[model samples]
Target: MMGKNRKQFYFGGSYVPLGLDKHVPMSEWEGGMCEMRRLGINAFRAFVSWNRIERIEGKCDFTELDYAMELAEKYVLHVVLNVGGMFNNIQGFRPPPWLSYACHCRHRIDDPLKAHIHEGADLMLCADDPVLQEKAYAFIEKAVLRYRGSPALEGWSIWNEPHGDPCYCECTLKAFRAWLQAKYGTLDALNERWGTVFPIDFPSWDDVCPSVDMSPYAHADPCMKLDFLNFLEDSFIEKFNRISALVRRFDPDHTTTFNLQGIHGHDMDRFQVTNPGISAYIEELAVNPRRVNLWLNMYLRSARTGRDGQDKIRILETDSGPRPTGKRPGCQKLASVRDWTFVAHGADMILSWIHRTRITGGHALQASMTRWDGSTPPRLETAGARGQTILRHQERLLGASPFSGRCGVLHDMKMYRYATVERWHGSFNFTTNSHDGAFMLMQDAGYAPEFMNDSMVLDGRFRRFPALILPFMPYMTRSLASALRDYVWNGGILIAEALFGVKDENMEQFWRKTPGCGLDEVFGFRCADMMYFDPVKDKILLGAGEIIPAEYFRECIEPSEGAAVLGRFPDGSPAVVSHCWGKGRTLFLAALATSRYDYENTALRTLIASFLENSGVLPLFKIRSEQNAGALGVYLATKDGKTADIAYLINYAEEPISFALFPDAGILPEKASFTDILTGKQYDDFAEITLEDRQCAVLFADRKDTAPV
Candidate 1:
């Protein structure tokens, strides 16, 4: 294994296939590689279409891909070969005419192209279909097996964004039945859980497929519907694992990844999981100037980091520049700063989408590094500049990781997705919002959190944290509840927010009062009253503070002998409650509220800060500015170079400001001296630096050398 301090980072663009060319031309691809090396880019990626490489079932060719690889070698550029054709038409997969005519593939009723052939709108081979998988694997094996010896293969994008999973084909039906049979073991258990019965259980399971429209099943048992969705999600994961295993058998030196919409497909948004075997992530939820899309999208792809604990994420494809308003000028600064944010956050790579702009495809907004005539654009220059920075600081930046923040906001796909479908659709909602809202508050408080998704919790990775902020997790399982309890009992702080442990994995309301599933034992509180508080109608006054904003759900806690009321509502009911559990205490905020990172509300901000301070979970690094004067998005990155621990600061405000750096004592120097890298301008006289509007700066602090620079 490589030393801990050593790492490799990819910086480049997707070399778009030469469109409108026959016999697989190499001129444009070769030119793209030359351009990449000239820009100081060490690597570039290209999407190799399975359908195009093997247009005929048996007769296959790697003309375009082989040439592309050869050019990459000639130009000394590392190649991230994205295999598996995605998209529907001319730009991506060209489903063999034989398969198209022979009806070998399948599509869901909702497939846009199902109504009329539009050529690659969102077409994909049915992985569940035996005949298609058999032929598809043949194409995959042949296309990739030869590349096993290719020197430029840094990574393999097995597939990009398969999130829109569809197709209720015959084979999928059989797979779903097998999955259910294995899960339930018998029809009795299945019927009991799903509230359904069939005389011929095996055949009945085999006969069912994805529901085109779930409306007709309005009165049907929801668990049954959710089961199918779960089955479909499992099938996709299985397929990813199968293909990934195939590639690793021949090419073991590269990282493998799947595109986002978690695991792939928008339909599975309510529930998604990763293939633990997949080595990397080429994510979605990306746009040009990735910051504009960073946080929320990070929420969607954060689970990727849970794989191997090394958050090696890359942008496989996305709008090369801002997709808004044609091609605006001076957008490069934002783009570069955005790229820096990704690096500071521990992402190993970023490919800013296409190297050559699109002309023939349906992707009009898909701008690339260069214009159609191959002229360098501002976007490419910015990307090149970002790449240069990564190349220079590759060792320190990649070697160090994000600081383990004092407090965290937890997230779970299983709970959030299930709750969304059940509470809003099945009418059993416990909280108005997901934990993303609480994350905004965490950010506003100038804290970066470790995202603890369900996988992380299940893998026993959440125990190390000193404190965790769980926001509105209603669909927690018995095991997860015990995990949380164990953390709290083992002297770990837990601040659970709203509807704390009230529902089960199935979103089934636990008959017991609030804090269900033995969580009552953990929290030491029982629900006295439960109802939604209408902001306009009812009031929840927090002590002498203003009325708490109306929230979707509120649980009035009746504290037990050991628990105590920290805050109360206007009606004299407890709004915030705390109780000692073993070595630590759990604080429960009874109402849901969100603080905007930039436009933070006074009441909400004050409330959250007090909670953190009281729990001894204050922010690790404090920006000694005029009490939130500027809209600066502060992100701190550790530096273990010869000296100097670093924190990256991005001024999101329209104007510049000089903010002092005073990290928590042990995390930084007691004297706190620094210098900005962008300008070798030393800050020996003081511990602060100025940044322009929408600009980025890196602070280098040496603990051993505390004297001002």
Candidate 2:
């Protein structure tokens, strides 16, 4: 029931109840609801803070709850109730003080008095505590019982971004020590891994204290730090699971999920598994740096990450209010980019962070759709238009899988997270901070970027993605290395970048007598000389014979028996090379030289575009006319052999361009004559059409006997 197929459409709405004031009635709620409904918003992820519901322990209030549910049902809008409060116990919802006392345990590692010194918030209850679990279950059971039969309820969000630093309270320390002892048998083994020198008599695990002090060589092992991070992630997952089980008992059909703070230090892979149907909150700046496009590429990739392909992807909250810091980019551009991108990426629902300006409360700056003057902003209009477009085309876009073929980019979550830690060492900057650049390049070139998990690789799914791109992943497990070697032997395209295969599971440099695939042979290169360039001088040097530029730090290596150089370093060493392994191809970009914008250049774009074209991974789209060159947006949707719809083109820029499309050309549209769905502009002639930038054109085509365009 949680994974049922729901018709896909851009469900758009704004965040309501921007503040916490009981006296402020729902005076403007009706108008805001009417406006969103008119604009085609079918779903709303409204917040139902825990602190607000049970202000005092056992003193529950359902007045606001009943009002919200009634409003949702009256408007025919589904709701995703955000139970956890938003901020760091500042506003929105939070656990009441009395409830906290009831659930509090000695296992919490964070000190209540010092908690506000860091993020300025009281310590949250430890999930491992039995008392905390009982209270959490009680709260969820009560809430679910009230809304179980309500037609307005769409889903329940367990907690808001809970991925932060570990709680260092005494309670957590004791639990952690117990956990370590069970795994290693003794504290001496833990000390060995933690690099702690055992004195004449080392203290027992029970006497050990969890301290942030990483002084003394003994207590500061990198492996220990890594393990601690993993343990914290596991603890968070346990909390989420406890809450999910409680909610499911009363509301079996409702979905449950948690939002991850994008690019934050949380272990996403673990969080994704804790609750299989999780949806990520797509922050404005997190995915879309330019603030123009909706980050369509990342959303589609994330949607597919749902377990067993049964989860619905939705934008928990988008930026519909003022730009943070009143930046140069206007809110309209941000809204348009987000709106159109959501439609393109197949997001079923969209919710913004604000619906009305908060007059006298927390975070007043982050307003909703209506301003302080009770007037609608330009962004509201854009959201409405985009919502209408999605509603009109929902049937074709939803419930369809976009990826085909076998090639995929292996996404090792551990490797990706570890890459972040490695950045502090200052040796590599190989797409280290972000995977968006590498992912976008592959997608824009028409290749489906499959996120192959590490476990999936061990299960042989790694071989299914005929092509695998390891974008500067420095560490690899022994198991992963063996899988890669086997995949290569069986003919799989392996694309690797700089500083890869250098570290083992312990984060130690591999020092074997014979060179392992770790780094010495995987890319036919080894680290010889590495340099960091000043940001101003960080330019990729393009060789005379090369199409793309060479990176700043170049690794010098000799080609293997079957490998040949495709591009070279300044010193004539191989930079980009191709090696034939079994029946597949191995492309090695030996340096970390290019920026994300480099992939947008015409040359690299054309090269990658051409590669995908030849690889037979391009999507088949029907068109009314043919086009070449210029910025193009193409979308294709297909159902069981009965019917298919193709969204031809849209220009997101501000210039008009023309290209030719020949009916007999190899890339012709599948339909003869098609009707334009956007402007309703019909075309039956086979001729080139000039399109103005920032304008979208959609043509609906059928396989019936129609004249060729």
Candidate 3:
């Protein structure tokens, strides 16, 4: 099973044991595993500390692995065993001291500095080292050979998040030089791309050394830093390939996967630095199609800015009520919402940081379901309820392939890269970057969003998607823009938001007089200039004809095209407009608007919904309930070849909500009865139904006709 057919809903807990020195009793471990299974969790992610397993070189310990595998079998759960223990703030499973010596490396530096200061630890081993690679491959070979047949061991994760710059030691430096020499024929080509002086700083491939310090000068050079980033990623991939090959040699049936942090800018350095190699590796694996899952480490929150006005609090502490010291709260509520929304987008599995509340040490401040009192916290209840809903509908969800219609959102990594450049160069006057906002909005709209390099869109993969929403994609390669124009001319739906096709890849703006390439003819708008709005100071009027009220201003831009206005600016200019392109359509939103009142506005929501309805691509499902306020919680599931089996509605608010009954798109019974799966209450199909807050209702309805929609 590959592609969408293999969709799996994973509900796992981050099971990080406090101390690696001692193993938990079997009874205790079994009890915890049973409880997790009872809560409907089907997956468990844990690590085997290398330090504990292999205390000495050439020795193996299977005590913890055996226990974990036994518990997984007992609970009918799948395991995603992380190989290398935490390095980047994640706990590292310790490796035996002799293994590093056997591999010709040093000790592990994954432990706390205080604990390892006198031990002379080495965090990472050089990937190119033959001894290390052989030992590593052998270790994996043995490990997988032993556990490969275990039905509980679903897959193996090679390593934790490998950082941008790693192992500048002699071994890695030599490997990097070799890689560069292979990429560029001679030192001259390398120097030309790196923009380095010829005679003053030219060095032989063996003598070339990357700067140890990553300052603006060193990091800014796309060629140099990009190569370095590629080298690091390649090294990690090589190690993973070795381990994966070993696993597959023994257990080819079991799936292999890895966790990638999905937040913008942090894990990703520059576009060229991180994207090319990383995406290539991902594509290769994805075609082989490794399970792509998102690991949400930090909840989204309002981060505090530094003195220079850069966001300092990108990550914050969530408050678990008041602490015993009556100081330091836990994570904020907004962060939780944002985090959950990310999972809702495409994350097949939501792997939290820690499952149970820690009683001892390390990350005591981290939020978990079980609190200090050993009782389930409110967040636990929330997570459990949400998880249960997902579990009940897992089969349908996994079966329902991601939207396969020929429509994709054009996400250019170069635009994001250039935006980073502008941020560093201070060339633009924008507060909040619109790229994230656009991506999030498209995701919320239920579009299959993928990050594409500007060049990749021209490779004809994008032509498969009938529609492409390009939101603020600033830097467009000439080939990409031309491809888009050709796509539109060939009856493909194209939607371009503000500031698109304005600048080329070199950050040079296309003159207004320039014909065709300038989005003018495509969008029918010659964006003369754009303006930033303080959201609070402006209000958008929905022109009295729209379904939802337009209240606030997100961002405002001017439309030069005389397109049919779907919305207008607060000053009564065109805000949202649509124009025809050949047999296709192009939509342009001059300003960002909302259709839902919560965090998103209502107008934008209705607009998108309406667009889907008009496009004849909206899913066919009817949410019939008496719930009024928490209407947003209603979800409908339909199997492609079978009759829709379940209709789920959840009320996340504090009070009861009622909703009017609506007929199932075309499969509704005249007077059908529905069995509430949660409460087991049988109710005749009425005009409406009501549900209490934090409560979910799963209705099993039999169609009177038993015909598919």
Candidate 4:
């Protein structure tokens, strides 16, 4: 059973038992368990599909799951069972036929050219259907009660990527109406907020319906569409609450959490749990493995501020190797950095996709730790070596938490949804482009910033950061603007990029000035006009005589009193401006500079570096490395009441690089001694250390306290 002080870091891969779609025998299942023990894997995910467990309505089968739990107990391994209605669509085992076509109720939204039904396949049940919810809850209750006391059961994954975006059937329409009623309170209020008129006005609540057309030119009103999207997400959260409450009624001693697909579709503040899980596949979250740190820190910050205020997270699914027929090589190299990245960020558990490859069908030649015949490959060997290394120092490592920066980057969910509604480069591309670029730029300068989401802003968490960056944020809530003003008034540095606060909380353009909600006075600027241009032809000139290429979006600005112009466009328009407001300072870039700071952009990096230094927010200790030493990562941690602080270094470069650390006085004791945790090498003073490609190093240094000297 897990308690408040429980601190066991789990690491393992998933496995499919016998009699599933893959048709593995019981012998192979037992062998897989043995392999887990040999590889130092202490926990795994056990899948319980609704279709498989309940072949006939009102009758359930627990034979296979029972044996799997017994095997886990015998092997001294922990199990995180995957049950309930909301599981992965592909491996979640499609719903049973009785729950599928018998009720004639499933997602009816589909392409005009394609059929909705397939042979031997079933769609997910409509979540708004009362009958469906009753049966799903019944199944969940029985499953939790059966294994609540099992020695090996650790937790439950109640929802897998809970996104109901595709369901637009009659049942969903009914739910959407009810949601609107609760929000607007009356049809007249709804009509006023939605701005509905004669031909399109919602005369009655019954006339309101969500749009099924998702094309670029769909005629759905942005206001109505936004509410529909909110309703979908809220419906999922409601289902999660009901199911979680039911589970807790029977099993209150173990952890309960749900998995989300990356960080796009849901609100971070809505759901709070001790352990929050995410599906962190590189293909889904990052363009390449080297950029995975951006998502890692974003989710880690969310988990750190969870219900129990613990810094524990679960990577419910990550890539173990490359896909079949893919051109990417060095699977072992990528896998090592991926798993270690989780550890560097203070993650509690790491669970990859699968343990062994399948022998047949479309999933043939899929990536797995072991071959179909149960032989360990080079990748598996690398995993085993890393596992042994982590197990050796679990006590000290688990006791420490990753250090967070005094800086913050804003991630506004309202702006993210507005982008989707406006059809401006889509949601993920628009938000992550700016958020990831700002995050990477900070890390490149050896300052890793935490992410402050919309929830954080509303809850007064934004005031904790000494410096904050708003990257390409265009939408603003009145509450958020008020918080930013208060934060700046109390002496916090604020930096915002292009299109900051052009739209209100409801995606309405501001009538007075661009930075709405009194932010014009706070930032000392008003956007007169804006333009989009071809970045290849335009350029920006900094006050220091540095030439930087322009990006796609730029804003024309008029500076207010006490504001100074720092940069100019080709036409001599104000490109960047700075102001003194209250006791703090504010900087505004007329262009999206942060979105364009790639690995090769030196000019932008220099400009951003100057901004940090001028604001007195740069890291005290600088990590210097040779050129082409691709994206080195540095993370620090300290045990409670201990004099030794730990630092973790990760090198993503292809060639060997020499690293040196220089400390600023009063921040790090100049006479402190260094000890390598992995190698046990002691250095009398800070010295140069060599790290090969994709290497991770842990160093311990004695300190007077966890504060500046």
Candidate 5:
């Protein structure tokens, strides 16, 4: 129901009424609910850990949950009930002591009580265990049947930050074998693909044991490692789907969602790949504003879609206040910036980690909406103010959507899998850094492009974009290669960096020409040889004898007769080439130029601007500022009919600065006026707007022919 129109916004905090015995206390629930209502907060995410309600098997005392639902109904607040196997409380994944003991025994491990749970906090019951999963299902069914009719119950959150780490239990091993058998059909096929030999040979399906050794020196078979990761991901997806289907079976009217951890160990293309509702936490996970922007962009792309369809995107748990661990403390200004950033990025909902202070847990001293005595803090006030502003502008906000032009950056999980196996430590950043860099480069050039995954491409979503960029993608599949070739031939501009498809999807080197999989002809070049380059020392020779810095890796490219050399290495070997393929064009960089950009470098941004210009991809608008242009982030949300748009200009710098928004040639040609949403003041011209340090301004722009303000 929430995704029906994709226009609603929900804002609140996470409230944990952990039974009647713990957290915020039974006495403070009514006050907390009253405060939430008074602040104009519409919804909150409440949790019910398995350990808290049913410590003893078959006996669930739902008094705390029932009271929470009643209070929510009384306060006229909606609730997104988080019911799952793992509870991310201070105790951390405490799955009923009895269940933990039983699972340890079944898995032939030492007693869970004797184990140091903190060191291995993720070690819990094998999710593949049938009996254990049945118990979980029964518990969920009971909860759903009790609250499905309640008005306060808006939906259900089934999984919280799902992980794909293998349990290595007997049940999990059996499930893994089944998964492999279904994939390969025979041990010979599996062994051949994985190159299994004397030491780690899988004579039988049962002989396969997933190796979780990610140490720096561990020499695990790359193919086996990739498959193991895939198997675990598949298993996680299966469990989540089963639970989601179970919830819908009983409560068909309500929606089901999951909170995604950042895209480090997990892959968004695998989980909630194309789902309509997606939630994620970003408080402690993202270190800086730039990374926060990156995380939001990635999640927004994964959650929401292009013009064809849309999804409900929620920042489920952002920081509410300062943490006891002073490393990443939260303040009123920081909280405000983060909340507005989410709103600007098109988040449908924004919830803090908590509403009230905890009585016990590792985060006992962490910041909350209310203090121990149910008093509001500065951050709470900030939330209330932001909520009020959002409520006031709900109509315009709902009618508008972020405008991302026809350009997409590819986010392939196979490349992630390959990097994880080959370069374990910083492998996760290998693909992501380039992605973030490319995204920022586009942003700096006044272009808003969405991120597309392999599944989206295979399903024909890639055809929606006029240009596609592949940043450090090395793994290639036959089908994907074919699709990409067709895309380029049909007039799609493709920009790629070094090591493009040098390896197959299985992480094996390609036998054909260097670009591999018929791509050498598509790009009119092949990688002759490659070597590591120094970021500070190596230089690439550009047009008119201009030189720019190169980094990390370099490829000596051999170009076809029809290809034009764009740049050359120090020794005059072609480093960047541009070629015409069919009706489209392909630009290939034989170096890691995209990944080498930082705040100090203008090379990547300049290169991106040139490519976009040459390919005729016009940016939405241009920013004119005397200050640091990178410090100001510009976002535009266009009304459905394209008669008006809303712009959010955020100044991430410390000092005040003035800037102007000049619409691109054909975009917003006859715009009439700009009105600040917060101040309710209208300006007829878009010449100047000055913002203080870390401040943001929201302006509504109406065209000349639209309704008058």
Candidate 6:
């Protein structure tokens, strides 16, 4: 298990201490563990709160955690320890009162004008402050030393959904200055870039303080606040590094990962205040929305894959429903689907939000894997049984890692971050809707596209892909632009949307044409002009069929020497163009498509269908599904060695849905037969297989086209 090649798959839940105003009984821990063992759960997540273990200054007691670990060991379950995450009990992740009194650099929201102060609110400590970091180091060091040689300890996690209010205290202000100095190198460079004349090294950037406020940047200089946002991210990363490093000091072999919330979870559902009257600890339900969760898991895992190899990403927290409000009878069945989806999508562990529900507290009446009555619930019982069933096929999954796709779509995490901080433009707010839209369009067009990020692109993951797409990737860095250009030059077809690379790394104006980064040259078009307007007024007219309405924005683009006008506006301006570069090609659309209506139109669909001539072949498991109603709703792949290829059909509707499966176009596999791996029902027709509502089916077919590895 210690080897780099080792792969782990397990099901578990967070063990919340149920003690109301006193220490929880030993029977409670034992009962939870016993239930886990009975349910075939081999792992559990436990949180160590700074305030709980040590309510008084310099006083420490691991009694609660010790019993929890002992119970885990007795039950033969592995542990993923969340040293510090967001919620703790009914209250949030509040530091010991002793520490807060020592240094009052707790986090503050953007609206500093309100003079916000709450005694026991869910306040975040200043991540960049040295004194607070020292305390955190000490706290983690003690925990690490205590559990140094425990075989049950699998990994360490620091940020459990790490999104919160901005920290604008004195320490962060000074840290921001140092961060800017390191980034820009000197005061003169900072002054020249920001167009500000601050004295020298330690001069004040401003007295108003950096914040999530956009008015300052809109009214003043954009670069200043933008740097501040970067500084905040850097600060959070630094803090996580410090805490995780302390764990590594004692246990050198373990891997550390951070479980992050999706964009909306971080933005609107930020954990700034601990108001029991409003919502509980696990109130926000963003991660369970099927399409969003699948895409999120893929993108989040992309961040962890590297040259050394993929890290065993233990996503420690996410919503497992039967949420407090809705009458979701489908939730229990959904868990197994979600669990299998996470695994098939490359998640190694699924430690759900809770083990037992918290009762007689502020967070009482919250949903948990176990009911408030302490009886075994079907949600957990069934999900765990499915997990055990899945565990039997660990080798089938462990051997399968490579997910082949035709196109590589770029996901700019930094753009998402900036959008959450400063919403400069409503249309270009860096929401995941663009991702949802683009993914749906491609899926509907019979294509699977892997999400590529800065690191994935740099790592050459997209080198062999025939086509690449950039959807709503507004701000492009100089390095990124060069990298993408090189990809196109190297015989890779490139498909990019409007506003791709319009700005440099610092959000500065680009030197090249409107789309910038010499992309205009590559695509054989100079963006003469651009504007955002309602699609109802100005529409896109292709050669034939119905006129495709421009969704949100359009541009007055001019075709260069070798470029061909694929489509034009009703007024006869180039709305989309195609250019051949080297052994590859480029299709640059000058309009942003935010709706299925934009791409599903007859003219637009016909245009995309034509591009399939060189859009690279998909993997052997090509799916033609009737379940492509909302977003992409099917997962298709071949087993290791092509012994069998399977297409997973997920029906999220009220009734059953159907889809056909086949090998990719222009290929014939010898002696292929279909069987549902779960039901043992052989599919004779190879034409259409119907899956009931909220049901998932895995159809397997042996393929002789590819040899087994």
| Best by the lDDT measure | 5
lDDT of 1 by residue, 1-709 (tens): 1101137777776664532223223666666667778788887667777556666666777777787777777877777666653532211354565665566465433343354543454444555667677776776677577776777777666655554254555666678778888988876677677664223233455454433444554554556667777776666655655666777776666676545533212222222222211212222222322234335324333533443333455555444654434443335665655666666666676666556656555434345567657767766776787788778877767766666555656665455456545645244333324455566556656566656666666667777667778877766688887888788888887777666677776667776666776777677778756788665666556665655464666787778887877677667888777788898878777766441123335566566667667767767655666534435656666554222366677765446767776555656545555566666655543355677766877656644455533
Scored against the true structure, residue 324 in model 2 reaches a CA lDDT of 55
lDDT of 2 by residue, 1-709 (tens): 2223366453654345322533235776666667667767777766665566676778888777678778878887777776542433211344455545554443333554565453324545544555555665677677778877787777777665555346776556666777677767877777776663223234776665443544343344566666666666556566665566666666778677655544323334454322322233334343334223224454455545523333345566556666455332334543554455555444566666556656555546554566665566676777677678767776755644333423465555566446544444345445533355555555545454655566767777456565766765657678888888777776666777665666777787655511245434544544544454333544333344434543444444557766667666545566666666555556666665333433335455454444444544342321332333324444443343223344445554445656443321333345445566666776654366666755655555544475522
Steric collisions counted per model: 15, 19, 48, 0, 1, 0
What lDDT, from 0 to 1, does candidate 4 have? 0.70
Candidate 5 per-residue lDDT, tens place, 237-318, comes to 7777777777788888876676676554454545432233345444554345555555656666655543232344567766
Record all residue pairs in model 4 with backbone atoms less than 3 Å apart, i.e. clashing: none
CA lDDT of each candidate? 0.59, 0.54, 0.49, 0.70, 0.71, 0.59
Quality of model 1 by C-alpha lDDT: 0.59
For model 5 the TM-score comes to 0.91
Alpha-carbon runs more than 4 Å astray in model 4: 2-5, 18-20, 85-92, 101-120, 196-199, 212-218, 283-309, 326-330, 359-361, 640-644, 663-671, 683-687, 702-709
Output the better candidate (5/6) by lDDT. Answer: 5
Model 3 lDDT per residue over 371-452, tens place? 6443556666656666676677555444432223224544443444465455532433221234444434443344424444
Higher-TM-score candidate of 3 and 4: 4
Q: How does residue 371 of candidate 5 score in lDDT?
A: 74
Q: Could you estimate the TM-score for every candidate?
A: 0.86, 0.82, 0.67, 0.91, 0.91, 0.85
Worst lDDT window (10 residues) for model 2?
273-282
lDDT tens readout by residue for model 4, 1-709: 6323357778787776522356455667777888788888888887777777788887888887888888888898888887654443322446666876565545444333343554456465556767666677787788888998888888987776666554556677788899999998988887777774223567777788765464655675578778887777777777777777787788888887666776655665566455778777653433343555556655555444423323567777777655655443425655666677777667777887766766665545675667768778877777877777777766667777665565777766666667877777554365667877887776666565776777777788767678888998888889889888988888889988887889886788886787888999888889867898457877778887887665777887888988988888888988888888888889888887777676567677677667777877766356666664435666766554223356677765555668776543434434576566666766554458777776767766754344321
